[model samples]
Target: MAVEKLFESENFLIVNKPFDMYINSDDENEKNTVTYHVASPDSHLSSSLFPLHFVQRLDYATSGVLCIAKNKSSAARAGKLFEKRLTMKYYLAVVRGHVAFEVADIEFNVGVDPTTADSSHRMSALTTSEASERCLQSRHAHTRALRLETGYYDNRPVSVLLLKPVTGRRHQLRVHCSAVGHTILGDYTYSGTRDSMPHRMFLHATRLVLPLPEEPLDIQTAEPFFSDPKFSSKWRSDTAYYKYRNKEDFKGVCDILNKSYVIGVQYKMYKM
Candidate 1:
């Protein structure tokens, strides 16, 4: 188990996740799971029995930082925050199209797709525009995607974006980015015609803010996978992924919270 620990506390520990890893794959696939990769020998989830509880589920095709609860009590509390839509999740991505809109809140129904089992997840469901409005009003997971830069690739523009998801849906960031005409780079499920990456989707779960007991937990961390240039160079140019190289933004946010998360696994990843 080679898990890279980002930050550890009595309540939770954040780790950098490997690409192509499921947060919680079934036992048959545990060897390829993020839990199996976790380096810490903290006896599963809590009482030396269950596996650690994963509060947030980053898409299997997506890779980045993840929060894991070491104990059952903390796990329950953190899970509630996520379920109640109190925790804020952010992702940095390169979408396929340049978004003209600076910001927009998307409302849609997403469920299992009866079609291709080739895809691991279900796509969007059929819902009326009014019903979509109600979905937004009730769930209140507002995803704001900010366009950073755009470039032409084969006569198409790929937009670098910062996504802030106010609520956590199964694949909210991917779907929301897709719905807005800018599906994430390397996204297979939401691709328009025929374009994808050899690796998982190009969305990184760069930061998380969870409400804590004292002053409300505010922990910001990045996937070590993003810190390296070679890993990014596999598909896109440096201009698209350079923001992640300088982790000053994460440190700044950590300072605001007066909390710092330490890196557990600083693996010297080779470029694939």
Candidate 2:
């Protein structure tokens, strides 16, 4: 499936990024550039001379709403919003098993460690140090997981969650989920699934709230929106995943998200 534009303007644009799609063109191979999809008139790729500057990043496995700053001024303003913690972003994730509830407010930083090439959200780090060229490299790190929603899987609840990042780091969600002992269903690197997620990994970046050009602006939000492929389901499952069928412990993951988001609402405005 090609990239889909949800909305665009002189100041901003929102694109529906597909699973397995790379967000940045600098790293995009000829086969999968976001610009190629937007540049061609065939798809939602727009024909603006102004470039699409990505404000935030999502892992290749994740999907859904991504904001782009159309002009340099908006890009600068939006960048500040993210840095100042004034932006509100939300994600919907499908995790393994059922959630036992009441574990939300899971806060921690995600920092890189030279000693360990790997990081897990398990909040389970036992630190180590490395000396490279007479320099010591170390970091204090921890992360948390909580149940957000328990949707009906034949009257049995399945864990669906809204993951909020306190300190964004590479593979934070996957690492965190893996740390919790309940890895995401389609995650192989984090979950230790021998062969996981035939299609793309099952994470989505559902919502983003952008502030207006006007100072102290009200929040503009995009919600429950998906610009999926035209023949989405026809895509075959390409990867095989290991199922850790732990249905008993997961329930009502959404409730946790709502509670946490409500608490954090007064913090900031996030827009591109």
Candidate 3:
């Protein structure tokens, strides 16, 4: 349960949180959470940044850039950015089928599924008719997906997507992806037992931007699975079969994203 420290300053600390680890757990038996490692006496972060205050949360099965505030004042400032929906979050994911659209916006309402026995823990997208018929607890979720590559995973068709969640709701990305018939690979709850299980979920939070005072805090983590020795053998990029409908538009989008990596201000051009 080691956390990679990505950035540290007087007010904030950003870390690459490993997948399959909880941020916090009510179960006393659990010791693999991010909070446990950060508070451990043996950890380097214990003395300087104890009593951790997380600005946002990543799912237990998702990994990447996670932000933590060093103190209360910084926490309040960072919290405002999130509350105002001024922060940007980007994620990388591999899904079950070839994504038809090169770029499309997925908007739907996500809520607890009363139809299933696991309603308490499982979520589903409520269709317009369904939403109007029932008074289920739900929220409007919006996400923009950019298909990066179409490929084969363990001989089954899959697509690599860069996801931008415009509105943060519980399991927004997962629910939206599934609603459009491309449930993320290795997402057991959404895809069910039909798809082959990978070592871990194929979703990773690749980048985060926090707009603070004089300068914005931007942090990025490399896409983990693409180069992973364990995952490479099973992944095959299919450049021949799939082609973008609008090649220039796709290329332009990629260029903007790449430029944003180096010139931080360039990200605003693509931000929705």
Candidate 4:
């Protein structure tokens, strides 16, 4: 229930939401959620900020920068940015394997999982051709993954990746990562029984960039659990990793979208 207010403006309220908490719940009796915490009468924020309109959502297991519009006007403006795919979102994750590509531009059409049970939620990543043949409801999803570090977690090879989602589809990052054969750790929904049992999912929404008129907002949160001894260790300190980590030059182009996405990963992380 502890949500840290990161930045607040007249039109927006940015907060670092914790993991394992719902953004909101259908059951009014559920007081353990982000909405309740921010809107509660006793909240530290002003009462005028009541009934905060969430501009976006974070999965129950995901934690990081979340934007809340203080009013409907602001919400509408931000909503348009999201719909137009103008917002930039970055996430950090510890996955189950050493990723083959140091830098990759991944494109997959994500659709409802045909294999998942009716009660659970799952998404499947398919090639453009495969999606048309099997998944009528599939939507285009794209993500750029940059491997920051590779190490062992509990004797198993794991990779820490900085992910940028070009298109915001439900579970796009998770589905794309899993499709690459390196499911994010503790992602039981995608990793299933083979994944480890971390205290929470190893995925976090680390940064968000919104191109709002006049003044753009770029907010970021520090690494939540990447350095914990329980999660990773014995990291490889190759000079190449440092080169990319230090400079801002890892780039890639997507043939599917015919667009180039160049991102600089800045992380001072090493585990011994």
How far residue 11's Cα lies from its native spot in candidate 2, in Å, is 1.0
| Model 3 Cα lDDT, one tens digit per residue, 140-181 | 777877777888988889998878887888788988888788
Least well predicted 10-residue stretch by lDDT in candidate 4? 246-255
lDDT of 4 by residue, 59-143 (tens): 8888888999888899899999999989988777878877766567777778777666363377777754635544447777778
Clashing pairs in 1: 3-39, 5-264, 6-262, 212-216, 212-217
| Number of the predicted model whose lDDT against the real structure is largest | 3
Residue 215, model 3: Cα distance from true site in angstroms: 4.7
Cα-based lDDT at residue 271, candidate 4: 10
* CA shift of 26, model 1, Å: 3.1
After superposing candidate 1 on the true structure, give the runs of residues whose Cα lies further than 4 Å from its correct spot: 39-50, 114-120, 125-141, 152-156, 222-245, 250-272
TM-score of 4: 0.80
For candidate 3, which ten residues in a row score worst on lDDT? 263-272
Per candidate, the number of residue pairs that clash is: 5, 23, 0, 0
Residue ranges of candidate 2 with Cα displaced over 4 Å: 27-29, 40-50, 113-148, 151-158, 193-198, 213-272
Cα-based TM-score, every candidate:
0.72, 0.64, 0.81, 0.80
| Candidate 2 residue-wise lDDT, 147-227, digit = tens | 444443323234655566654556666655654445665676656455253455657665566565474322222332122
Off by over 4 Å in 3: 41-49, 115-119, 131-135, 240-272
- Give a tens-digit lDDT track for model 1, residues 71-141: 77888888888877777766677777656644444554554444543564545422445444323322323
Range of the 10 consecutive residues with the lowest summed lDDT in candidate 2? 242-251
lDDT head-to-head 1 vs 2, winner: 1
> 96 in model 3: Cα distance from truth in Å?
1.0
